[model samples]
Target: MNERLLLDHLLVRGPASRADLAKITGLSKPTVSAALAGMEDSGLVHLAGEVLGRPGPVTSLYDVTAGAAHIGAVDIGRDWIRVAVADLRGRFVGRKDGRNAAKNSEDLVSRVRELAQAAAGQAGLPWTSVITAVVGSPGVYDKDADRMIFAPNLPGWEGSGLGDRLRTALGVDVTIENDINLAALGEHAYGAGHGIANFALVSIGTGVGMGIVVNGELYVGARGAAGEVSFLPAPEPVPADDDTLRHGLTESLAAAPGVVRAARAAGLHLDTAKEVFTAAAEGDPAALEVVHAEGRRIGGLIVAVASVLDPELVVLTGGVGHNLALLGDAITSRFAELGPLRPRVVASTLGDSGVLLGAVARALSQAWDHIFDLRQSGVQPRQSGVQYGMSR
Candidate 1:
């Protein structure tokens, strides 16, 4: 208990003297002194010189030694793979980004391993040093089947023994989470949703999905598929046989291909959502019309989410969703027309960093749990805790 208190104080207050720790933690001076002695002897903390301020004799200051151990995080997208290694404090020590050129599950697995190794090496550590790793993936991970489901963007990802392959390659317990879920968690932990108890993140890009946070926790329903909003019905019934419908009905209309389709049908002849947005920015009538249509569709989906969950805030993200300068007003206008209970809709501040940051947050949480368990069980800690960059 004393150890945990001291560590928690140091984590929140940075390096502190024994007197400061005692005062902050409400512990006796001898207790703080004893705890610090044990912690320093265990290599969990180190002297950082003396604390200055108050009038008494200078008191020694100590801080968590950050180089004790590390964790890893990966964001696996259809076009890119990003990997990062962070110390126990959750500060990223090394990072690597690579294109996803793999044609099959085996190739993808190998690529992830390669990227993880590269990140670990850059952190001056071996692969085995990564205590835990979390991977942010594009679909719902069915743990019972150990495969990814609902991942039309990634063919053959389901039932591909990906979980086992990742475990074998990394030699550590690997956690796979839906990318959108990670994004919501990221926003809650670090970005727009910070301190907000209830919020939803709707991501519209190559696909459409949402991550819901209710009362300070992620609401992943049964089968880990609660946020799969792609199947929601839209005004224009996308043909069931349409290839884009593979992801879902709403997705086919609110996502990138849908945007491109709208642009082309409007005589714009655009090839990508980026082009559509660019054209819209230039006041192209066709492109603007398409974007307005998509905003209404996306707004309808958000209304559905609000009517049901009524989150405190709604965050828009992804290649198309983050185009707030172009789509924000349209979405708000449509929402106003549709309902009386509209939450504030905003764009993600983290941009593309949400998924990877969320992964690292989870990894750090897991690693710290392991360390705390070891400490409670009387096991000498490999390394203690520290407050890294970007406070969690």
Candidate 2:
């Protein structure tokens, strides 16, 4: 069984020949064969046909059955809910995200349920075929307590049974994490930080947040608030006689509110930063200045982060991350001026779904651990999704 688990890992992580799987798992050819036979019987593994070999019969390769299991990822934000159904191999089967502010916490939960169902339907799965579901919430959390500590965006999120409710409603093991943290994890596992040992994900949007990956592990931090970089005060003091426009910190200056506020000051009355960015992208001079100034705010922080953490990469993501084309030069120039230990600065690779993608990855990781750990603990694996009529 242990050899079988090792063989499973080999097939899932990468396509491998039986010899390679035996070498990696430290098993004999017969042991590998027995494990492969079992996995094949279970529909979890299949041969990739013959690989050309040198002066010998073709060697067969084995790979995972990616469609055998599926995962669900949900992103719950102040103004929207995004849901995606991803196959076992991390291929996006289907997705849906729409901008609709929840009237209250109940409405938010209901909307997420609706979106998850819709996503699964689009993916051609039964209403509940997901093995695990991970959610991206708007605030910090204490996973130990299954409690949200401070999620200002989701009014009734913290100090409640939202996790329990979500798990019950979705009929899957539910895990919730901050969107920015999930974004960082997503990038680490599948995006830009595929092999880096250390990095930071600086998300600039409705709020500014950072996620640190140290020694190839996501740094959850003391109290789970390690990367709330927006709360960091500005190094330079506010000028005594300056306009109110000059905020204390760089993130407030660079973040969405700051940009929209600056645009409004420049004779643009955009209620949301979306309006500001739209006008800015369409060649509005006032909106352009807002983006430029927003760059200055983000630039200083980027330099500060680079100098402090000295990570290998710093990726900017979120709603505002897309505007890097408009603001990249100014921010990069400022960062270079300030740092000797500057890291690579890049925009998001996976677009706005980076966080949701990360959530999916996180859920998959947990499911992976659950597969091994529960057996060791003499506990049966809980069925991840609604088991159709089987459970009922």
Worst 10 residues of 1 by lDDT: 383-392
Candidate 1's residue-wise lDDT over 286-322, tens digit each? Answer: 8888888888888788899999998999999999999
Residue 381 deviation, candidate 2, in Å?
Answer: 11
In TM-score terms, candidate 2 sits at 0.85
TM-score of each: 0.93, 0.85
Error of 1 at 188 (Å): 1.3
How well does candidate 2 score on lDDT at residue 318?
71
**Residue pairs in steric clash, candidate 2?**
none
* Candidate 2: Cα lDDT at 74: 91
lDDT (C-alpha) at residue 148 in model 2: 78
1-392 in candidate 2: lDDT tens per residue?
75446645764577788887788778898888887775665555688677885677788888876776678899887777899998767778989897757776677778888888889888888656787888988678676777776565566677667788788788888888888899899999888877888999998877678888999999977787888776677544533333322222545565677677778879998988878878888998888888877776777887878777889988888778667888787787777777565568888788878888898888777655654444354432233442211233
